[model samples]
Target: MPKRSNYWLGAGLVFGAAFGFALKGIFIKSAYEYGIDTISLLSLRFLFSVPFYIFILSRKRIQEESHPQVPTITWLKLFAVGFVGYYVSAYFNLLGLNYITASLERILLFVYPTFVLILRAILLKKRITHLQWLALGITYLGIVLAFLKNFDAHQQKNIGLGAFWVILSGFTYAFYLISSDGLIAKLGTTRFTSWVIISALFPTLIHCYIENRLDIFNFPIPVYIISMSMAVFSTVLPTFMLSEGIKHVGSGNASIIASIGPIFTIFLATAFLGENIWLEQIIGTVFVLIGVFLISWKGKK
Candidate 1:
């Protein structure tokens, strides 16, 4: 009974995380309306988020001080994972969002689980289960249908380019999760997350510096409010919740719960951003959700 209760609690947490993450597109779009550029906005997000990470990291360091020393190599691995996973992947995703609808961007980003599956098969020499192949087929077909609609509904060249960047974001994120699996298992979710975020924050600052366009004082107040909300609600809150959810419900079930994110994003986009939803998007989202369900569901068996 306690385990069952925990499972429900974890599911709730995961759903909350998904909902929070789904709000990111809406927030970014709102920020853009204030004439805030991507780099500055991204910088603001990390700036607010970094203090939380520092607190988390400090607590973790104190806790682990009594334990056997961590190897230098481990820190290097964490740094590498942070760079490619959060910094690079997020930058590309933000770039894609500049050209694509929030709904489309969320849908594309949600396909990372599928990428993780495929990459594992190819790189790890894992056997491709029959059900997985079916999931892959469904997911790809859905993506194709959605892409066709996007191409038809918007600027063709921009849609095509945006889709490419979003897809690359998904790929990089998948690779990050797959590669960092062992580290996550060893370091505990919150601790590992703290280190990764801390590592990623530095690079983000460096990139923002290189862009050299962030006149931080001159931006309107709404941008600051929205960016801070983004840092707390979308970035820090969801990340820790998802990590805790994985601890209770396990990653597979957590992922299945998170599959709702794209749908939630579509609704938010329509209501807030006034983006239209068409039949193709509905059908594509359904297919993608089912595909993700199949993959995550089968992993438990």
Candidate 2:
């Protein structure tokens, strides 16, 4: 594909991934209503998704008839990255959701873009451009605007702790985006994502085993259905799309594109979860879109 086409493809993939992930919060909230715990829910998600990952890997391997051997170190690095990105980040996020609304969770997660930008600047020695700073400020302001009402109405005692957890979730995920960049370029998004998700599956299983037992089958039918949807739509599909998105857009722009996630999640939550949509969220969504436009506009021109 030409450079322009590649960029647009990446943007589309990221936006699609964001939409999928936005739905995750709703599924999680719904499952929680059935008394399903975080570890169990996560276990079910991976249980449903892991088989597909393995199938993809095996098929790709057979098709290549023995591909070039990856360095052992690189494989190990991929596992480690996946552990942080998927397992740890997801653990914190699911647990955080226990204490916060789905809409708040989405906005908190949206902060990852700023984290990605800052990580690139500090760790990779990338220059922090003035435009990026402006974009970052606008994006964060939108987030604050989006969540302010929830923050006020929140009667949950754990809201502060919940915010802390989701913020950590964003931070760890930023590291994933940063670390996965070179790997995605080298391994291709499909192969890299398949392996990493598989890698993350181990820890999830282990955690569930130690903390929550693998009783996913014991969940109510609604919980099972929601978990399956989370696995396919939110986990498997979005994971690959995000990997490919980073490949095309670079992590910084891809993360910025992800800011749309809050808007998506807010609407989804309002519709299905019976959450109210306030004027503040609308204003916030507008600002977030403007920030995205500011970041993406130059590329199209």
Candidate 3:
């Protein structure tokens, strides 16, 4: 393939993955309406996704001289990341969604890009350029505007708590992104993802136990279908497409493209869920796009 064509193909994959992720939020909201709690929802979601991941891993033609063993310490680290990053972050996100609009939840979650930049700077001792800082400011202003416009006088009571959890989830997700990059380099994306999913099983199982809803056989047909969709549409397909896109376009471009997800979600929420898209959301979306572009853009003077 030509370079230009590869770039466009990668761009398309990124957009598709973003749309898949945004649609997952809609499914979560719908599942809640069917009386599925976060734990049961997560358990079923990962349960269905695990086999798909394993099948992908199994198809790799590379044969090991010996079955590659992850060291105990590495297992612990992977498990910790999975538990804190995936399981915990997901739990809080679902909990916050119960109180806030999906659009609001998305904007709050988009704050993670800024968090990623800041966290990288802190942990790696790297300084962001002036343009990157400006981008961050613009993006944060947009996020604040979106929040203010979405605020309701009647629902002001829970906004603080909801915002706190949502932001916390974003932070956890950022950590996951940063930490997993190194592991992905070492283990390859598919194998690394499979391990993380397996590690996540422990926390998710505990969560299901705490919620006391382990009876999957009792779930309604619609709930089963939606849960399976969450696995196939949201988890497996999107992740594979994203991994391929990242391979072709590189992570920097992929991140820039992925930043558009919140804007897409805002519009989707408006069209499908009857959520209002305020002028503030439009302005915020612009800022976020600018910020993401600045952070990811490369140039030389």
Candidate 4:
């Protein structure tokens, strides 16, 4: 594909991934109404999702006609991603969701773009473009402006702790975005996504076993349905799209593009969770769109 086409395709993929992931908060909140805990919900998500990845992995392996040898170091890197991206970040986000509204949870998590920019600069010595900086400034200005009134209006009692957890979730996930970019480029997004998620599955299962939360089947039927929905729409699909997104746009640009996620989450939260949307938020959404467009259109990937 042409470079311009690649960039637009990647942006669309990231946008799709963001919307899918935005629904995850709604699904989790819905499942929580049935009294499902974080670990159990996570376990069920992986259990339901991993089969799809395993099937993909096996099919890819067969098509290749032989196992390609991966270095021990590469395996180690995938494991690290599994640990931080899947286990710690996911757990923290879900923990925060328990205390905060789904809208707030997504808003807090959107801060990952800042972390992504910082990590790229510090770790990869990647140059931050003028457009990216401008976009970042406008994007966050909108976030603060939109949420300035939100904090006062927010009714969650443990907002501080919840915000802290969600911020940590953003931080860890930013690291994953930075660190996994090369892996995605080298391994191909489909294969890399499958392996990384499979790596994630082990630690998740171990945690479930340790906590005696392995019995995911005991959940109410509605919970099971929601978990399956999240696994397909949120987990499996978005995971690959995000990987492919980074491959084309780079982690920094992809992060900027992903700011749309909170917008999607907020709307979904309003529709499903009855969260209120203020006029300021609508204005902020316009600002965010402007910022995202600056990065997306002003460059050719």
Candidate 5:
């Protein structure tokens, strides 16, 4: 494939991943309405997601026999990756939803690109390009403008803690992105995504077991339905898309592209959750589009 094709393909995949992930805020809030705790809800999401991953892994193994067997050390890294990416990151993200509005949570979580910028520079020794700096600045400004009105200053207690949790979620996920960005290139996107998600399931299940939250059969049917939706649409699909996207466009660009997630979240919130869109948010959305255009445009010199 041509370089231009790869770039646009990667951009498109990351955009789709962002959209899929943006749906998660709505999914969690809906399930929470039925009184499911965060651990249990996460457990259900993992459980619902695993079988599909297994199917994918199995199919890939049979069809793509040419790739070398993965090293044991890499598997270890994958386990650690899974722990950070899925378990720690996901757990905190859902936890924050309990304390804050979905829009605010998305805003805080989207801050991960900043972390990604720093981590990539330190870990990979890659310089931050001027375009990325400009894109990040504009992207963040848009998020702030878009969210400023929606987040109530007078909201109930623990807003600070909630913001911290979601920020933690983003920070940990940046580590995941940096770690997986390289792995996905080496191990093949399908195999790496499936194994890491499967590995993450272990810690999630163990935590659920320790919490005595593994009783999946008792949730209301709506909770099960929502969890299944999250598993397929948000967790499984987006995870694969993101890894493949990183393979195509590299992690920093992917992260910036995904900053669109928060905007999508608010739009989805307005559509599904009856949230109102403000004029400032519309202006912010325009700025976000410009940032994205800067990232996606091919004429950067």
Candidate 6:
């Protein structure tokens, strides 16, 4: 593909991944309504994703074993990242979701890109441009606007706690991104993903046991199906596309493209869940898009 075409394809992949991730809220909420707790739901979701990851790895091993060599230390690093990033962050996110609106959770999660920038600055000794700083400020302003718009007197009861958890999720996700970037470079995207999923299995299995929701095995067929679809569509497919897309687009563009997630989720929520979009959401969405663009779009100097 030409350079422009590659950019478009990467943008499309990122958008699709974000859309799939947004739909994750729908499935998770549905599963929660069916009496699955946060831990249980996440456990099942990761467990189901394992096979898909294995399949991808198996294919890669057959085709390109010589291309990327993943060391034992890399596997260990991925495990730690998966544990903190995927398992812990996702658990907290779902817990927060139980208390707050999905919209709120999404806005909070969108802060991950900012966190990623901060992490890069600290860890990689990278200096951010003035425009990037301005964009970060604007994006944070949009987050505040989103919260203010959605703040309800009745919903304020436990929102503080929920906000804490959601912010923690964002931090963990940022660490995961920072830590795994090198690993992805070494292991290739598919193998790196497989190792992370494999590493996640232990934590998830322990979580399932603690939650004692193995009775998900006995849930209604539709619930089981939806959960599985959540694993495939939300977890596996998107992760693969995003990993590959990032290789093509670079993480900065991938992060900017992912800012569109909330916009897509807002529409999806309105259509299927009968949620109403407030004016604040519209304005917040624009701010997010603008902030992301400002941060990402720069002359090649």
Task: Point to the candidate with the largest TM-score.
Answer: 1
Per-candidate local distance difference test: 0.86, 0.84, 0.79, 0.83, 0.81, 0.78
Model 1 weakest 10-residue run by lDDT: 148-157
Candidate 4 structure quality by residue, lDDT tens digits, 193-230: 78877888888888988887487778789999999999
lDDT of 2 by residue, 242-295 (tens): 878888998668866876787888889989998777888778767766665565
Candidate achieving higher lDDT, 1 or 3: 1
TM-score versus the correct structure, for each prediction: 0.94, 0.86, 0.90, 0.84, 0.82, 0.88
Ranking by TM-score: 1, 3, 6, 2, 4, 5
Q: Model 5, 5-28: lDDT tens per residue?
A: 999999999999999999999999
Tell me the lDDT of model 1 at 204.
84
Off by over 4 Å in 1: 61-67, 155-157
Candidate 2 wrong stretches, greater than 4 Å: 1-15, 155-157, 241-259, 292-301
The TM-score that candidate 3 achieves is 0.90
**Candidate closer to the true structure by lDDT (higher is better), 1 or 4:** 1
Model 1 gets an lDDT of 0.86
Candidate 4 to native Cα RMSD, angstroms: 3.4
lDDT of 6 by residue, 151-255 (tens): 653644587788889989999988997888688778767777788877887887887886684554766676777789999899998988897788778877787
Question: Across residues 1-301, which tens digit of lDDT does each residue of candidate 3 receive?
Answer: 4398898898899989998888777778778778877788888988988888778777663554456766787777788888877798888888787777777788788778778889989998768878878888887887787777656435435876777888899999989988887777767887777778777877898778766847655777898899899899888888888988987788777887887788778888878777677787788777767766676673211
Error of 3 at 85 (Å): 2.2
Show model 4 residue runs off by greater than 4 Å: 1-15, 125-136, 241-259, 285-301
Where's the lowest-lDDT run of ten residues in candidate 4? 292-301
Please state the error at residue 53 of candidate 5 in Å: 0.9
Clashing pairs in 1: none
